[model samples]
Target: MYKIYNTILDFSDYLKYDFLSLSDKPVTQTPTSISIQFHQKPESNFVWIDSRDYPGLFASGYSNDPTELWKCLNDAILSYFGVPRYEAKKRGLPYSLPLPNGQAIVQQDAQKYAGA
Candidate 1:
């Protein structure tokens, strides 16, 4: 099955909360491969390919590995803050595509979270 981490509010805010609350005992297992696309975004950024399926969204600081996840989360935070020439550029925003290895996935620019 496919899982999606929809950012209900500001991506930064959600990420921040997740980091602070769940960082201690982060979900170590990899999440099922899914397409995560940010609201009001042009394209899907990241592709998470794991076997486990995460049912909810994760906060920024929350991670199984505080150190490693922190690095990635920090980079994501920086990119969201619009830091010029940041390593995690716009294309690095938290977005995913849900599809099997042999299947094709297409990105939609329309409003998918309008009424949700």
Candidate 2:
């Protein structure tokens, strides 16, 4: 059976690391105000959790199988660094991150997630 879960990031951590984000429309507010409301989307490309529990602190992923769940989470992180899931699995690496002077190369596939 699948269960709901959450992931969180510290404000300081978010500030220090580069991540991906998407924008959301604000709730009711005055038109004259300069401030606007924004919600942080999942930095991961594979999954995103939109919850109201903790504002920007609480995020979640849902899956019945633990392995699949972790894979999705890992995939999301890897995609952020422009790595595909297949490459990470082949190299036996949790995920791939670009090095300052090194590049991670992945061949284009006709179908994504198709096993060799």
Candidate 3:
């Protein structure tokens, strides 16, 4: 499934963007920090990846493995920023674990999760 089933990110309701109108965007810029916005479903794990100061992106995934969800979030963010997957392995998508009840369960580790 490539890990995409559901997702979300915090964004202002008033702002707008023309993502389809993208041009001259960096094909591969230095990767940025990211995080997983996670919520628990009755029988599954849910994760959301997005940034408040950036685009109104909301990429989500459902699974039992948190690592898989984190990888999903990482890919979404990388693609959104025009950062290639190969670059993620190098520069890495530095981020923390899923947030359940607005708290992180694991310490941030880009080294272990990058290109994971």
Q: Which structure among the candidates has the greatest lDDT?
A: 3
Q: Write the per-residue lDDT of candidate 2 for residues 17-41, one digit (tens) a residue.
A: 3233322323222112111122334
1-116 in candidate 1: lDDT tens per residue? 12233343345544644445433433232222333322221244333222223334332322223333323433443443444331232223333332333443232221331222
Candidate 1's C-alpha runs over 4 A off are 1-64, 86-116
lDDT of 3 at 112: 55
Provide the global lDDT of candidate 3 against the true structure.
0.50
Better of 2 and 3 by lDDT: 3
- Sort by lDDT, top down from the best: 3, 1, 2
lDDT of each: 0.33, 0.32, 0.50
Error of 1 at 66 (Å): 1.7
Top TM-score prediction, candidate number: 3
Q: Estimate each model's TM-score.
A: 0.21, 0.26, 0.46
Residue range 1-116, candidate 3, lDDT tens digits? 33332111111111221333323445475334553344455655654555665666556666546566665666666667776433444445455455564555343455654334
Q: Candidate 2 at 26: error in angstroms?
A: 42
